[model samples]
Target: DVKRGKWEAPELLKEAKSFINKHKDSNTKIGKLRYMAVEDKASGTGLIQSISKQTTLPIRAIQRSTDKLSRTMDVILYVEERRVWLPANAPWLLNYIEEIEGLTADWTHDHDDQWDPTIDAINDSLAKKPTVFD
Candidate 1:
């Protein structure tokens, strides 16, 4: 919780690893993203609170940019919603990051040249703003 925004992404990743090492147990993973059911969609109070408390990230920051920060770190315990879920068997959403590029999805396709963002179809889908559902 000390050096969140202030620290570099790699440092934050280390923090995430430390957090995950402490939290994850049998039948439960800490770093992986999960679908969460919330009480309300408009305010997003419960969901935000849960994520904030668990991730040690401020709600405002999470609200502003969720994926960017999350992709780098490994031990983020925050909960996203079903809205973020891609189509059935979304091979693109395999992972949240890459070493060469900035924050980007981990595509499952073997033929893909990840460096070519133009061919990455996942970006098109992600370009659409996330819809809040109840």
Candidate 2:
């Protein structure tokens, strides 16, 4: 789609606003969104800033410092220990599982792109240290 055309800031803002509104109307609570911080050599700060202003949502622009393979490897123990859970019957479940299953240590593999944020979510939201009840 990049070759066809890419979304401009205004379009991105509109889509973000609509999506947030839908979640709000449905009583869904979304936590802070983590936007991968663009590197100094890249050109996306303006877009992220614009969307932040338009949505007024808690958006954390974070730079991923660790290597993808390392981050991917860290979650394995959590999965083996049953700390990661997926919603049953979710429409995206199959594709998500497929992507997870397709992940490999090979740097050339394409599945990492689909799994980066997912691993982030697992690390940030789900895979916490055990409590007594847990």
State TM-scores per candidate: 0.20, 0.69
List the global CA lDDT of all models.
0.35, 0.59
The positional error of residue 132 in candidate 2, measured at the CA in angstroms, is 19
What stretches of model 2 exceed 4 Å from their correct place?
1-10, 25-44, 127-134
Q: In the order shown, what is each candidate's alpha-carbon RMSD?
A: 17.3, 5.9
Question: Residue 62 of model 2: what lDDT?
Answer: 48
> Which residue pairs collide, candidate 2?
none
Residue-level lDDT of model 1, residues 71-97, one tens digit each, is: 323222211222233334445444332
Question: Whole-model lDDT for model 2 versus the true structure?
Answer: 0.59
